[model samples]
Target chain A: MDMRRLVGGNFARLRQAKGLTQEDVEARSGFSQQYISGLERGQRNPTIITLYELAQALGVSHVELITPQNDET
Target chain B: MDMRRLVGGNFARLRQAKGLTQEDVEARSGFSQQYISGLERGQRNPTIITLYELAQALGVSHVELITPQNDET
Candidate 1:
């Protein structure tokens, strides 16, 4: 599987689980909406700090953003 | 707290815990020795794919590389 897609899909699922929109994530993460959108679409390869900020914004562990779910495991 | 330092420190610690040197990590992850050294020194902001590969090389979950230890938590 594409690692970027795995990360992007996981990130999107976590954000949606918390009922957050991309705009909300952008606001909380201080990343641009375009950046977050690109991330969710698997068009970006985020740095560790970016992942950290996004996890903080989603109120989840940073691991959650990168780890595949049980189905994928 | 510097997120880069936190990640770098955690990565180094995890690699050490596994008794794997930088060379070992480079060999296992297929990342360059310079890249691994830079990452361990907190001088590199690695992409998610890099982190994923490193975590695999360390035989641990990717989250372990980025998460702060209990002392910092």
Candidate 2:
């Protein structure tokens, strides 16, 4: 429900779906792998710019990464 | 392209669409009006919980607030 958790969950899901590793995202995003790990665990409170970078690296829009989907709807 | 800017722009847009004010959001989300102002100005880096609360108050998914819209798509 929280943005951090939502972002983390979505990030993991999308990354896995894309068959990407943390290293891959890090390389693409110019962020540290450790940062990616923390982000996935919802341990980091990212800035807007960071979110944009992550979204771009993941090939998803920032909205898709932050919004929670209603599976039923 | 920053998350702060994205969230602020989306928040302002949605709030205006709903005819809600920062005070209304503050009353609904239990946050301060000043904080809302800061948030809407991209001056705040909110926590996940804060984002969730804001989303609920605004009757939107967190994703909608954070993601950038592709006007073409």
Best by lDDT: 1
Q: Is the docking of candidate 2 incorrect, acceptable, medium or high quality?
A: medium
lDDT of 2 by residue, B2-67 (tens): 667667888899999999989998888788899889888989877556676787889987667766
- TM-score, B chain alone, candidates in order: 0.85, 0.86
| Candidate 2: residue A5 lDDT (0-100) | 67
lDDT of 1 at A22: 88
* Model 2 residue pairs with clashes: A48-B3, A48-B4, A62-B67, A63-B67, A66-B63, A67-B63
Flag clash pairs in model 1: none
* Residue-level lDDT tens digits of model 1 in A15-44: 888898889878777888888788888898
Model 1 over residues B1-73: C-alpha lDDT tens digits?
Answer: 4667877888889888889888988877778889878877889888888777777878887767777788877
Report per-candidate TM-score of chain A alone.
Answer: 0.85, 0.87
What are the runs in model 1 whose C-alpha is more than 4 Å off?
none
Candidate 2 Cα deviation (angstroms), residue B27: 2.5
